[model samples]
Each structure stands twice: as C-alpha cells, then as structure tokens.
Target: MAQFTFEGDFEILADPQIKLVESALQKKGFTNGKIVVEPVGQKGDNYIAHVKRFIYEAEDGTTFNMIGKVAPVAEQLRLMMNTMVLFNNEIVMYNLVLPKLNDIQNSAGVTDDEKVRFPACYGVVTEEPYEFILIEDLKEAGFEMLDKMKPLTNESVRLIVKDLAKYHSLSYVLKNSEPEIYESYSNKLSNLWAIVGAEPEAQQFFESGENDLFKMMHDVSDQYKNVVRGSLTQITPIAKKIQSYEKGSKYSVIQQGDCWNNNILFRLEEGKPVDDVMIDYQLSSEGNPAADLLYLIFNCTDHATRLEHYQEWIDYYNETLDHSLNLHGLKANHIFPKDQLDADLKRYGKQMVNLGVLLSSMLERESKDALDMRVMTGDKEKLWENTMAQMNASLLDISTIVKIRQRIMGIIDTALEFGLI
Candidate 1:
C-alpha cells in the first residue's frame, strides 16, 4: 500500500507534523505499518488552521482514523492568528481539561451517555512553530456537519443549545467542586478577543466597516444608526469587556469562544439532529456563556428562525443547564440560578450584535475575500490600507449583509424595548 497520501493543502504539512501524529497514535498502542492522510473539508475558508483525517493501518491489518489540526503554513496567517498560543490552549483543553471534566462528572455518578461528550484526544505536540493535535475522528460514529449556508431548524438549534448547556455547566461544577483545577484551567485560557484588540489592524478592520454598517442601518431607525456606529467604533473595548472572567458571578463560565455552525458536528437520524459534538477550541476562554448563545444564534440561524424562537431557545438552554448541573449534585439556583442567567443574557447579548455584524461579513464573504493573511501586519495603517478595500468588497454580499442586518436590528429593537442598550 502507498504510504503518507495527502489531499488539498495537506501538501504543506511538514515531516515534523506527521511525526507528531505518529507519536500520538503510537502512545495509544497503535503501531502503524502505513498511514494515509486526506483533507476532511474545505480549506482556506478556515483562516486560522487546517484539519485533515489520518488513517493508520497497523501491522496486523487493523486500522483506525484520527482527526488532526495543524497551524497554518501561510506565513502571514500564522503571525496574525498568534497560532502558537492558540495551539497550546487547545492542547491544554484536550490533554488537561477534558480529562478533568470527565473525571468530575464520573465521580458524581453521571453516566457517559447523559454527560457532554467530546472526541478523545490521542496526542498533542506543542513544539513552537510546528504544533498539531490528534484526536478521535467523530465521523466514524456518523457525526456530520450541517450546511452552514442554510438556516438552522429549531430542532437543530435545540440540540446545539442543549449540548452547550451541558458543556458550560461543567465549568460551574469544576469551580465549586474543584476550585484549584478551575482556577488553573481558567487562568491558562487566552481570551480570543484580546488577540483582536492587540492587533491594531484588526481593530481598524472593524472600524472600516462602521460607515457601511451604519448606512445599512439608516432605514431601520435613527437610533439604530447610532447604535451600530457606536458598537463598531467601540469594538475593541467591548471585546475586552467580555474577556473579564467575573469570578464568583452566576454569569461566568469558561466559554467555547468560537460557536459558529461550522465549529460543531451533529449526529442526525432520519434528517433530524439527535446529538452534537463540538470541535475547534482554539478560541476557548472564560466569559459569559450568553455570548456563546448569542454568537450561535446570530452567526448560524437566519433572522426569521432566530426571531421566531429566541425566547424558546433561551428557555431550552436554561432548562438543559439546570439538568446538567443537577446531575453534578449542584443546584443551579444556588450556584448559577436561572433568573440570574436571564439577567446575564441581557447584559452580554450585545456581543451578538457587535460581533454578529462584524463577523457575519467574514462568514458570508466569498472565499476569495476571506482574510488574506499574506499581507496582515501589526502596523494598523499598513494593515488597514492593505486590507480595507478588499474587506469592503467581501462584506458586500447582499444576501449575507441583509440577513445579518436583520438579526442586529431585531436585537437592537428588543434591547431598546427592554432598556438594555
């Protein structure tokens, strides 16, 4: 059999990265005779990293599959993403955090089926300038991705929210049951938004879109124009605000930083989602869980579906969270309390509005217009000058812009009605 087959941009994967995967598999008692690698999904669309499936055939003919993620080979993207830290954080999540979480739940007598599930991480390599993660490939268990372009059904949204609740509640358990572990894990997690705040180019990128977004909001209401403009200009500080861990608050959790549709995989039966598994923890950090809820709604669901089920979605998330916490022998009311969660959502949900408009442009933009890391730099003016024109072109997708605008306007109207903004 041929050895070390590759597809897509897997060509750029260097020998050291491959060796890391082999070492990870070897540690699991899988001695390989030959290995095959194939690209799993679309690339470049993911501006930060590339993922591929690795198939290993043992000397006895037994074979297993692993999913691997590696930092981008593109020089510009690598520097822009601060991928070293991102890779290290994810490695810590899989190697350190997941095991602690599983142990905490198991000791509480929680059954594996009822608890939140994540892929088994086989091995991790954190050597600087060449990091890769190897984990169990969930596709072998029939998990699949929903089409990101389509609006999520309520059923799909419910499944996502439920799983998110289960995942987030573990942070609560860790904090109360195992404070030291909680502090250690929480402290290590890098706030993903802080990266954007540090990068002057990134800040200006958000600023450049203000006028375009303001013009889009002009027809909605005069106040909307002000709201949109204010949110856009203050993107850096708002991002910083969410980064606060707010220790001992009911609202805080070590949140899944990137909660878009593409970051999740679902197990569907008869065309309906039954369960989901989360992937891509590169942006994981401590923050208000509501930001995750709002991010998923605004980024994944179309305006119509989100508006139709906004309240129901919140109810479903809180219900699931309550269930998850009770399983850990912790009372949600005493520790987190459902009523406080409602208040927290109102406080932090504007992230959905601010990042919703800013990020949706990237989500909807043509693949060609995806951030070209090649020219990215710390020099704000140079980065802005090099990027602003093409960035505008990317955000000009009418369908995407309209849908995002609808979600933001809906959020604004509700905020105003509730005196939230």
Candidate 2:
C-alpha cells in the first residue's frame, strides 16, 4: 500500500493534480497527516476517491476524525470552470443555509424544521486543477443507499416530498432576500438534456427509443400519444428554458437539478422513517420547484405505486410546500397558487415526460449495468442484461402495473384538462 501526505488546510483537495493539492493542504494547516485514497462510489461521468479517516489531536488531548474527497483528472475537466463555480456556490450555500437553519430551529416561529433536510457540510475548498470538499461521511451516519430500481415505501415518498418542499421554500426565500447572489449562481446551470436533444445522433437514438416508450405510454392510456408527441417535440425548447431563468415567476428556489432516490439519504429511527437528507449540490440551480417534484416522482417511484398514489402525493407535496413557505413568512398562494401550480405542473409535466424518455434509457431493467458502470459503452448485451436484472428486481407485478397505468392515465387527464398537450 502507498500513502500520500499533505500540509496546510484540508480545502486544497479539489485540485486534479495531486502535488498542488498536497501543497495547498499543507498551507491550510493540515501538516503531519497522511492521505490514502479508497474507492467508495462512482457515477457514469465521475469517480469518487474517499480519503479515509484522519486523526487530529486538540489542545485538550482529544482526537477528532475527518475525511476528504478527490476526483480523477478526467472528471475534474468535464465541468472545467463550471465545476469550480459550483464548488464556490456550494460553499456559500453551506455557510448561509446551515446557519440560517439553526436560527430557524431556535426561532420557534419558523415554518420548516431543519433537522435533516440538508447534508452536514464540514467545509469546502477549491484550488484550480484540484478541488476537495470535506463533508460528514453519510455512511457513518447509519444511512444506506437504496438501489436504483427499488420501490420506496409510502412513508418514504411523503418524507421526500416534505424535504423537497422545504428545499424549494428555502430557495424561494433566498431569491427574494438575496436576488443578486441567487441570480449570479442560478444563471450558470447547463441544460444537458437540451444539448443532447439538439445533437443529430442523440435525436436519432431518442426517436427510435420513443417508439418503445410510446408502446408503454399507449398501453397505459389511449390519449397519451398526443401528449407524448407534444412533449417529445418540445424537448429542445424546454431544455432552453431550463438553461435560463423564466420571467414573471414570483417564487424561485434552488432546484436540486437531479432529485432521484439515489441522490437522497434517509435516517431511520427505530425502523420508522424519521428524516431525509439531500446530496449532490453540483446540479443545484434556480428553477421551478415542480421540476424537482416531477423528476423524483416519475424517475424514482415505481410505476405502479406512483400511479396508485399520484393524486395523494401531489396534494401532500402542496401541503408540505404551503407549510414550509409559511414558516419563512410566505404563503403558497403567493409563491405557487393552485392555478399557477397546476399550469406549471402541466407545462413542466411535458419536461418530465421528455426526461422520462431519457431516464428510461438508463433506468429500465435492461440498462442497469450500463448505469452502474456510469457509461454507455455501446454494449447492447450488457444493457439488456442490466435492464432485465432491474425488471426482475422490481418484480413487475401485474396488479402493480395495472394500478400504475390507471394512475398514469389520471395524470394525462389532468394535463389534458390544463391543455398542456
């Protein structure tokens, strides 16, 4: 085994180049420490190197445990300047949001409780080619990552909705309170979906895949063709809107650009759901709160359960949103009125539909391995194997599918009522 050592503060861990990172850490007050990289997790585009526990003695002869994260050069380069910008934004969010959350807890007059909505941020450091973030290790907190295809319990769904409401409420409050900072950071988000939709090759792949999804869409309801077609056509345009902020929407919040179950961590108290924690602020930006809601509901939940509890879930989310906003000295009608939320839900429903198509490619039973590997290596057999494995894992009960179809139909009917198609 090989060991790496660094000096200075722990923030210099972000540099892609190891030597510079070591020098920066040394400068920042982390001398007399050893660094060891361990494989913890990997996504399609990025790999995480977990810096194992470190021992630091205080003046009272007490030792504290700390950890760090480092990314490979390729992943570091993908976002380029955008990566650094996101890092800085997260640092600001941590400093601002974390403290305000504490204040909210003490005020008693506060609307939303901040026990476990956001991750515990130790600190963040960014230095050019190397960027490192020190965060409370989630694994150490007794939370386990759920499999991508596993169905969430009804309680899990409710908790997720509650946390999302609080998250959106916070962003809306921040936007009104600090427009300059919100606008500056929110403007940098990249809409990769729109970009891919524009590419000829990507379009072809989606067009072919659309037929399969259409089959699934039609099996659920007769009216979905037009809805699907319209959504598919609007993919590029919606992508553009997502790329920039829309005018006249009074309420704005930092959108958890990616809000799948995989990105969430849950803390269970005595086997009952107690708290939910959100991660991956890399995709955080200002956008419609409904976008995150739709994303999570459509992508993470099972087709059957979602369809069965769709209406209830929506209502619950609204209630949560209202409650959260009220705590921040705001009202749901002021931020997202019933009529506005419905309209946004319909318009944004199309975006979710478009996203569903993209997500299905990676989420369906046959696509599991590809997703696990975090890459599309153009291997059809592997894709099919992974997809089937997911399907098997999901069990795909007939009753579940039928119920899901009916629920999906209800959503389509609502969209039709709103003239979204």
The candidate that achieves the highest lDDT relative to the unseen native structure: 1
Runs of candidate 2 with Cα error greater than 4 angstroms are 1-35, 42-72, 75-116, 125-129, 194-234, 242-248, 365-368, 371-421
lDDT of each: 0.74, 0.57
- The 10-residue segment with the lowest total lDDT in model 2: 367-376
lDDT of 1 by residue, 1-421 (tens): 2233334435756778877776776676765366777777663346666678888777688888888887765445565567777887798899888878878778888887788888898777777667888888998999988776666889988888998899888888888877888888878888766666566676666677777677666678677777787676566676776565465455578888788878889998998899898887888877778778877876777656765788899888888888998887777778777777778777876665777767755666545556655335654355456667766644466775786576667656655654445
lDDT of 2 by residue, 141-228 (tens): 7775666656677788888888887767666766676677566656554444545456454454455555544555664445666666
- Highest-scoring model, TM-score: 1
